[model samples]
Target: MQEYQLALKDKRIAWGMAIAIEPLIGKYSGDSIRPGENAALDWNLPAGVYRAKEVVMELDKLLEAMLVQLGEPVNGDPAVLLDSLQANLAISGQHASLPLGPLALKDKAGAELTSQAVRIGEQLVIWAREINAEKRALTTYGAETLGALEFRSHCYGHPLIPEATRLVWGPLGGPRIMQLYNEYLHQFVLLRDALLPFANWEEVPFEIKEHTEFKGLRFLEPAREIFLTQLLGKKLTHKAIVQYAQSVVNSGLTKTGYGFQYRLGTVLPAGLGESAGTAARYLLKWHPVQTVQTEETRDLAAISFDYEYDDYYAAPRNEAGKGTTVNEDTLPVSREHYDGPSIARLLPNADSDRTTLRFSLEMEGREFTVDLGQLFRGHRFLYRPHGNDNAGDALTKRTSISSHRAIDILSHAGLVTNPDEIHFIPTNGNELVQWALLGKLYPENVVLLDKGDKEELEAAYVSGKGFGTQFLVL
Candidate 1:
């Protein structure tokens, strides 16, 4: 048992060493060498190459043993790892070391090292991104749940769960899950920050932000449930909410050229019967009439017209059977009559053309024309003046504003008198917290749309029920 424990300790060290060596080699290998600099003068090329090969081989053996000991089948491809290592080593050996050709050898080694370092760094970044995605998936579905699933599958003697998943969330997965997650985050941040210099040197764009930090906690499942229960009552299911949200997203608001159109509408209680409540009107079909007002007129150019006389009106016909051409002297002229104002004297000035969107809706006996474009700009919900012309851009920009502030803006415009009566358009998961906050504030009246609601609505439409009876018209 003592010997087994020592062997386990050695394997753990080997695993840790492999993780540490990845970034270390990637960083140093990519270091920039000045034009006159020699980075490999003391590298002992052949000896260094031999040691790297041995270290790689030993790491592979140790990792395999460690995985097997943990009852997890090895999933890493040895060939891919070997290829990466071999490529880097080959780059380093491109320069032959000779006593007489020391400078040539060193220069060649330095250049090749820089090239090889870049390739390693790129591969590292790709791996980091993939691992981060996996981490997020784990976070999305809690560690406990994942562990339980893996443990159950393993006990059933089925390979339903991936080996990595099993190793991470199986019987011994509790502390290791957090340990691995934290370790990966730390390594990712280190790598991301370190690569900044290399990115600048290579003129490549790299995101410096640490995006792996949890954001889902801001709008937890319980909060979602409470919001839904309050707004939808006990009659609506979670699936209904998701379906509504998805239907809104798939509504093709962008393709219809509807611009930014929204309505303050009400929906009947979940089992109240559609005939009893006011149906939400489809606002996308409402065309925005463009009214142009000429604020100023400017003189453009003098207008002129050319006229020809008939053969009978001409002086006489020549022998060629053509009427005699009338010159300024032979033509009869009429006295020029000046009207009150010449139409040619003034033209509509392009700079003075003021175009406005004219659209109005009447709700609860109150007729109001909403300048959505103006409202969005006034509230800084949209930074670009033309952003409102595209429904997708406008919706995306609106997410920048807090849901509470958005409601306030609508209230000020008289579009939202009661928060409970307003059904906000569906937004993506990134903006869930914003809309969720409003749902919490006015729990009874506000219906927040989610992706699932959209999906449910879509399925209903596919059944030929027009926007799905489950979805509230908005």
Candidate 2:
């Protein structure tokens, strides 16, 4: 055995034998070998068999050491090595490089080698199961820890390459192992980039940070650094901003007139400047009011009720005469001395020419009355007579007053002085849009009932905007 080992050490001899045994190797290894190519090869002859001696020898020592490390005992028998190699090859095709024939061991070993090989084979089976479990665990870890996009893009390939598997089961040293390491490191980089936009690194779990398989990657430190730098002093992350937007919508505020008219205050971090508000406007579905037109006409009316009595009550009373001794209470009293005209006389002309005209406007539960004579004196009052339904009372009606006329009337009544400023009822889309636009442009002009922060409210007040009052700030 020693002489054979020394002779095989020569490069020229080893190369010659390797070339000569190629057909036999390919046949047992399941590699594509030409038909009838190995028919000329004779395993029984020493010359034909000796060519594979070096390969068989190397495989024997390697397999024995692997089995011994796994606590399986081995005997120095060529047959045992062949049987164990065959068993491993059956389990995984990558092990097909090991020879299958008994040419090297037929003269030197016996049947007992088979039993010893079975023991080592059992250990190999257990090791293979462990490796498969580890691979599954690593795959799961990658999926859970990495972002969805990154996992799909970078980590979706085969879980374990043959070289990576070999590195785990044995100390297989080569460039392939380094190459696999680089691949894993590159995946870590993608993971870091994927999470940088939204994830808060301080909240990451320790299991992800100290992952057993990827612990050597050292990706967490730099990832955390970059993440913090990008999000420095920011109160809300990208994920948080999305959640806040959803919350606002859910609150039913977006459907309101002043929904998008309010300020964000300190809800956002300083890192995001004024531009963030613009982005938030779209998220909040802000549409400011454009041009407002009145949809309906309201009437202003003045009404008066008149009372009448018979003149017979005023007839001179007959004293002590039996001509029906006047029961003064029984006769109707005269209405001539009354302050107003009699209902009987006024009822016929109440609807048309004789009706006294006036304008009555009510705002905020207070009523203001203006005489039509005075109102139409300096102004060209355009009005249409609105019909009256009540009987026995005189009422004068006017309908569809223009906004300018309304403003002037309000000013004359001392209700409002600014004709340019208008209040938004926000009953329709256009009005709501106008309200939002006014709030955004002239924030001080709109009264924000709830500012969400006392300090912010005070600041707005200090800046000449009424924060809580119905009046405009300026």
Candidate 3:
């Protein structure tokens, strides 16, 4: 883990986003059906559990519709949404022991969606639809409805900012660099948000026209002088200035032809059904699994844990952090932020350098930043993994992620520890005891399970061939 973290900090390695998909098997079937749909059931009983492919498809469609409503182009890869979705399942032996839905609060439609599964004879099934207090089928935010709501206005596309604009500003008492929707220009807003006290960025409306028109027109005079002086310093003529601006607008940024593509009226993560504090959404899709009517088999329920890690996106603290509320923000954490160093005793090297560290991450398909030193020291991240795809020609892919990238990502994120410490040999069940003995000599040494090692251990415990996956075949 230390080595990987060092690599990330040194820019020797980097990773993209990752996701986990798991099939959920519900316990409700027969007359035990509930009035609302939750993670527990799909409302389509007797068939047992829901299919992962179908659940992903449903979610994809839902997100597409929502984006279209937000005025995003519906065509092209929907990677923006798919890249951030993760698979989650709730499992427990007793029907009532596991956390079930309505995992979230009631939506504005005044309907309660539940997570109830039942057993009919030898089969377990789930409820897929939503039911209201009157037991009437009503439209609500569920697997079926995409949780769609018109909370605010949104638009995608950049405003046309002319190159001739110029103005003056304060603070430095000199001209600053200028651009037509340039990244450098946007830094001022970010700087203000970070340093300005009592910054209510959420209440600050985003207007592409205002951005393009240079709302505070007076500030640009100094910026224009600086831009012209640089051009003249290079012995360039007026023609050069126009050409430079045009070239930048053409290719310096997104293919949308703007260095900073303006996506005004942006919706926060919570507006999209993400639980407060998490950039990703938590959903349980029920799938049917066949079970024999044996004493042990009858009472046993399967459980598994998976996680997706790559980077963390740092949006406004009020939008997706510890203090965000479910009413306004979806990414809320249950505890305070803690991403600093862990106890020296818990690490392999207590004397490792701490001055050089990097904690860049992505959240909800957006760039996010957080204090790693403040996070890992106090918080443990829990995530869901994308189930291995088993389709023809794609079966060779063991996980949804590229194996090498997954290793790199997990290590840098501090979710996996000491990749070299993983052993393929069978355990004698004394690893924990051995760790205590070893700790006597190496106080900083601690046993950490890398992803591969954890998978092997799980497979051994479940007597499975691969990553001990649990999915319904029906």
**lDDT, each prediction:** 0.23, 0.23, 0.21
Ranking by lDDT: 2, 1, 3
For candidate 3, report its TM-score.
0.16
Against the true structure, candidate 1 reaches a TM-score of: 0.17
Residue ranges of candidate 1 with Cα displaced over 4 Å: 1-165, 169-174, 178-222, 228-474
Off by over 4 Å in 2: 1-227, 230-232, 235-427, 430-440, 443-474
- Given candidate 1, what's the lDDT at residue 379? 20
Q: Which 10-residue window in model 2 sums to the lowest lDDT?
A: 8-17
Alpha-carbon deviation at 297 in model 3, angstroms: 67
Tens digit of per-residue lDDT, candidate 3, span 323-343: 111221211112223232211
Q: CA shift at 82, candidate 3, in angstroms?
A: 30
Candidate 1: tens digits of C-alpha lDDT, residues 366-424: 43333322221112111111112233322121111112222222223222223111123
Worst 10 residues of 1 by lDDT: 10-19
lDDT of 2 by residue, 1-474 (tens): 011100211110000001121333212322111122223210111111111122222122222332222231222222332333234433223442122223222211111122223333444334433333333322433322211111111232223345334542445323322333233323333223222221122121111112323322233344444433433333323323323322321222222111111111001111111121111221112111111111232211112211111121332222111111212222211112312111100011134323222333333344434332222210111111121233123221111111122212232321122222222111111211112222122122232222213443323222222122112111
Residue 291 of candidate 3: its Cα lDDT? 13
